[model samples]
Target: MAMTVVTGSASGIGAATFSALAASGREVVGVDLRDAEILADLSTPEGRQAAVDTVLARSSGVLDGLVLCAGLGPQVSDAKRIVAVNYFGTVSLLDGLLPALRGGEAPAAVAVSSVSSTQITWADNPIAGLDESEVEAALEVGGDYRGQLAYAASKNALTVAVRQRAGDWGAAGVRLNTVAPGAVDTPLLQAGLDDPRYGEAIRSFVGPLGRRGRPEEIASLICYLLGPAAGFVHGAQFVIDGGVDAQFRPTAF
Candidate 1:
């Protein structure tokens, strides 16, 4: 059976992915701050390291899949933490878990990014090449825009990192891809909907499909990428937004 590790397994897409993978008969290790097999705060250096160490130990230094779904929305008050968890925390694990991925059978990884990543301009987003500390310094200010910028920029940076590294990982017989979902009805989306800053805006903005995505829908895509069917797909960023991306910028993709 395949062994996989899912971050942010407590709820939302992460929880949904965990359940979906287990339902398919894969051995899955759940990692979250709570209600998971491995508990760790992915926002901090120590916490990310701990999550990595625990995953390697529990998986016996071999893993067939890794799904990174732990993230924060723009409603989060701290922009720095957004950068930390979304970019730095995620990339750290991508690098840290490479050895285990190499040791497994048909290893593949999928990360949850967002359609909003394309909305941010290059000039405003500094997370592409900056170190963790430098990115933290750049987003030190406190505000909704700051949080929004951090959220988008971090995901953009993460996408870039995965694409750039996909060739190397593929050479090692490990496939890597990312999923970008728009306005999914997850707890994170709920947070934005309930927040005073973005609630009305979120409720008002509808995609061409006129509905939000369900967590199972996104999880199904992730599971397919990890399975044997998508063996040829590599380093691709799939935007599954129910036509939102298409409606906004059909020619851009």
Candidate 2:
């Protein structure tokens, strides 16, 4: 059986994907804050390292697939925390697991980005090019609006990183890609709806489909990308946002 590691597997898209993969008979290991096979926070370097170590040991240094769904939304109050978990955390875990993935059979990886990356303008975003120290300094100065900016920047950066590393990953027989979902009806979306700061915005945004997406819908796309059919589908950013991206940024993508 193929062994896969899915982060943020406790809830939302991660949970849905975990169930789907398990039902398909693959040996799936989940990493999350709680209620997972490997419980470890993705927001800190130490936590990421712990998750990596445990996963490699558990999978016996061989991994067939990886899905990085752990993240924080724009409604989160801590800007640094948002960037730390979403961007750095995802990147760190992916890098750490690459060796194991390379050792496995036709390994593949998928990461979850957000449609908000396109909606939010990040041309002048300081976090885009900054190193760790510079990012911290910028976030500190950003004050009240840093969280939102961090959210967008993190996703955007993630998308870019996946594309940038595609060549190397392909050379090693490991495919890497990203998925950007719109307003999906998940625990994370519920948290945004519960927040007074971003509730209205979250509620107001709708796609041409006229409804929020289900977690399984996103999982379907992810699973496809991880399967044999996606052999040629590499270094791609799939926007599964219910046509929202189509309606607004028709030509932007």
Candidate 3:
């Protein structure tokens, strides 16, 4: 059976993807903070190392697919934690698992970014050119608005990183891509809705569809991207945000 690793597999889109893959007879290894085959947080370096090591052991150093769904929303209080989990966490895991992916048959990896990436203003964006010290520096001065900016910058950086590494990944026979979803009805979305600060703003951008997307919908697209049919689709960001982005920034993206 094809073996796959899915981060944030305990909830939301991650859970949905895990279910779909397992139902299709794939041997899936789930990584999450709780209720998963590999219970480890992605927000810390040690936790990321543990998750990678456990997955490598389970897959015997061979992985057929990888899905990076672990992330933090803008509503999160700590900007540093948001960048840590959303950007560094995803990048670190992908880098650590590259060897296994290269050893597999027709390997592919997908990361979940957000539509917020397109919404970010380039000037003074903390997420750009992120290095260890730069991320720390940004965290030190990040306040309420900057926290949201951090989320956007993290996703933007993630998308750009995946695209930039496409050539290298392709040479290794591994395809890398990103998925940007808009206002998806998940635990993350519910949290945003519950927040009085950004709830109304979040609700206002439902796009032409006029409803939040279900996790299954996004999961289906992710599964497609991981399959053999999507062999030619690499280093691309597929946005599944109803019409919210188009409605507002139709010409920009």
Error of 1 at 62 (Å): 0.5
Worst 10 residues of 3 by lDDT: 136-145
In model 2, what are the clashing residue pairs, if there are any?
Answer: none
lDDT tens digits, residue span 36-102, model 3? 9999988888999999999999899999999999888878887778888998999999999999999
Candidate 2 whole-model C-alpha lDDT, 0 to 1: 0.88
TM-score of each: 0.96, 0.95, 0.95
Task: Report the alpha-carbon TM-score of model 1 versus the true structure.
Answer: 0.96
Backbone collisions counted per model = 0, 0, 0
Better of 1 and 3 by lDDT: 1
CA lDDT of 244 in candidate 3?
A: 84
193-253, model 1: which lDDT tens digit per residue?
Answer: 9988889988966788899999999999999999999999999999998898888797998
Please give me the total number of clashing residue pairs in predicted model 2: 0
| Model 2 misplaced stretches (Cα beyond 4 Å) | 120-123, 140-143
**Clashing residue pairs for model 3:** none
User: What's model 1's lDDT at 95?
Assistant: 97
Q: Each prediction's Cα lDDT score? A: 0.89, 0.88, 0.88
